[model samples]
Target: MILGYFFILGNTNCTAQSLPFLPDELTQVLESGLPKTLPSPAETGRFKKLPAGDGFVWLAESTATLKKGNKLAFSKTFDAPLKEDDVGFVAVRCRIVDADNNANEPRPGRVLIHIGDRETLRQTALYHKGTIGREWGWYFHPFRAARSLAANTGRIRLSFDVQPQRVEIEDVRLYVAPSGFDMSRLPMMEAGYQGREPDAPWRQGADARIAKYRTAPLIVRVLDPHGSTIQQADVRIRMRRHAFGFGSTFQVRLVDDISPDAIRYRQTFEELFHALVPVPALIPQHTPHAKDGNYANQLLSDLTNTLHWAHDRRLPMRG
Candidate 1:
């Protein structure tokens, strides 16, 4: 039937809304379909009750166990925006059923319907017996309705514990409230703050010093081909443990961004990457005459080879 008008945000660049995605509007239309012009227990047509047999009403009893011969399957269809957060929200709002103790407040049961890369139940449905209905049903967690949702729409699920015998459910509303988040308040990002300053330089291959004089040690931890911490954080020294790991020789450029406050004070790459430490913590200290262990000899050789390669290949080593 005709539901509420909800708009989906897609590449279409349009704002045309429709129904089924909105529950309140659909409920109104469904409730008003009969002679009384309002929804009553009898007025709910194909609004089908959950579970297979035992009449739709009894399906509210989540604890009601059944034999293999008798089972129930409760399914519903909806049009919701496809996204990361919405999936979790829908599962909570539309399909959680808890247990209830009418004497005081009611407890709910969990009914999760997982359909994706992994077909598994997400959570349990809780049902609390309230005066409103025989069973308290919460199919999914409530989610804020976006003013403009994504265009990729699909049906969400509210499945009964398939393994359990009795699947009970009461009243559930498939709808969302208006979202109150204000995206306009988000801070606008600035350019040149992402390593685009003119003072930036290239220092790649073999731990080369990038900056000098800082609040603390200016560490440069090298990352190997694999995703692991190859070097510890330090400065002005070659990492000892990191000797085992060597990455492609490339330029490690550094730049300074103009602080919004003033010119004398600028935010440099050193400040940005200050948290990064040179991997391998302590280096194997060696005498100048000891093989390649000589820091000066290795530095000189690496720099010479790099400069020669850059000159021969006409690469941008100096910036």
Candidate 2:
């Protein structure tokens, strides 16, 4: 993530993504947006919803067992919809608003999008990092139109892949490339031709040279909105990619957990390591440790060797 890649999803239109208004809290959590261009679930029926959040937002999906499944679909409700913007990412929140922990299986969740004819989904896994008092951040693939599902009023669905999980989601948002603002318009557009997939993302050669010894090479440094540093927090990412059908993963040691109370984590397997936070820090804004809600956004930004990546498609860090 770069300075620009990081825009409060719910708060601003940093990345040219087409999204509905973002609720205040969500912007307090993650930055950037992901989009979906999938099939028109509206073809079946209208979008579904139940009372939630101040007035209305889809109910978060919850499963009774990590074994069973729960899902809900929402229809396009924009009084007036936007056009063919290219989506790069979708950002949303998820947490065990309520839970009956029969197992440590991470509660499952998602940020799903439906276009007229196709569908793109950003799957959420159990919490890998971050505090429970605040919603954890998850980034999925950008909304794609390449193999996109068509239409305006499609479906927005969420599901619980496993059971014994009750998750809450809010501040659904997106990162889009307005349908007509074709990057082809950029004078340097020819340099970005080799698109990327989720798994084996392109790593610049020089960046590879810089990461010569590490097993995973891309390292980013996150700064707070006021431009302060977050010290010693672990950095991890779950991103949906276009190269492969599913998505990709990346991680690095950010900081040591100071509190003895531990957060059980479901590890991710990232083979094409593209980024890391050379220095990860956090300003613990709360009390008796985990109970505090006082904290700043996890300063996260992307580290890239654009020059090299522009020439190659690889995650330079993985040895």
Candidate 3:
């Protein structure tokens, strides 16, 4: 999300203001598909209505007891078929609880979306063990519409596959945006630990520490052989690398490939980053013939080439 800043400067005074903008182009879809109230009295299926204060706190929500290999489907129909370039956004506030109430253990699950009879889009679990606690949390998923499903039909289906567990769904929301819309600009849950709020007491000290330790004043001076400063000399300072490690896993093959795309990828990586960690090609576990010397030698060659390439461009390798 882009945070807007406005600055007012004067000879002796300056002020700055931060304004956050929320886009208005997004349209909500699939509202009818969501369960408004707990399923009706006569409702009978895998999903059952659960009232508030029943081991959880929600005005009303739906709970589904899913077994291994079982699937629960929720379908919605749009007034018009989605365009091929449209983007879909999903926000689900849900939590999965094991039958034995073991919140510490990781639970495996999958969420899938099907448009008409076209291909299915798979997503990983809604919440991991680290994020899952006694309360429900929101999870966001953004997807693109495939060309085959575009203008085919107005029906969209959501499927949930869970291990033997009880899944509590507090809310589900869907939105659609134009193809070029920036998904990162969409609103999402803020992730942080305790004492991260704007008014938190710890923030003042944290900001002070950052200002004192993370930044410094830079002074450049030009001197002559006579031990006198050259007052008229021009000085330029350019940062060649970062003081901190800011890097990502890069594909080793792409560094030396002749393909146009690979060359562009390497150029972009070098332009934007100062360090890298080579992926599978240099990783020992991914080496197939670890016991044999041939594969080991090849990996060593790739590593040597990568190190030379990085060194030529002043890029540091983490591992």
lDDT of each: 0.29, 0.32, 0.52
Candidate with top lDDT is 3
TM-scores for all predictions? 0.24, 0.31, 0.41
Task: For candidate 3, report its TM-score.
Answer: 0.41
Stretches > 4 Å off in candidate 2 = 1-61, 64-71, 77-85, 98-100, 105-141, 149-153, 179-319
Q: What digit string (tens of lDDT, one per residue) describes model 3 on residues 188-269? A: 3333343434776678899899899988999878899998999989777888767877788887756666867678988888
Q: What is the lDDT of residue 65 in candidate 1?
A: 34
lDDT (Cα, tens digit) per residue for candidate 1, span 1-319: 2112221111111111111133332111011111211112211111234443542333333333334321233333334433322212232222223333342333223344422211222221221111111233222233322112343233333434322223333333333333333222222111112122343333231124323321246546677679577766454665333322222223211112233432222133222221221111112222124224333364445445545544453343321
Cα deviation at 204, candidate 1, in Å, is 65
Task: Give the root-mean-square deviation of each candidate in angstroms.
Answer: 23.4, 21.3, 13.7
User: For model 3, where is the 10-residue window of minimal lDDT?
Assistant: 9-18
TM-score, cand. 2: 0.31
Best candidate (score: TM-score): 3
lDDT score of model 3? 0.52
- What tens digits encode model 2's per-residue C-alpha lDDT throughout 1-319? 1112232212221122223333232211113222233223322122224455454433333333332322334323211223333333344443344333563332223333433421333211111211111144433333333223333433344443333333444445443444444332221100111123233334566458746754455577878889898788678976554243232222212222222221121122223333322222221321124222212122222113222332253333321
Off by over 4 Å in 1: 1-72, 86-108, 115-140, 143-152, 177-319
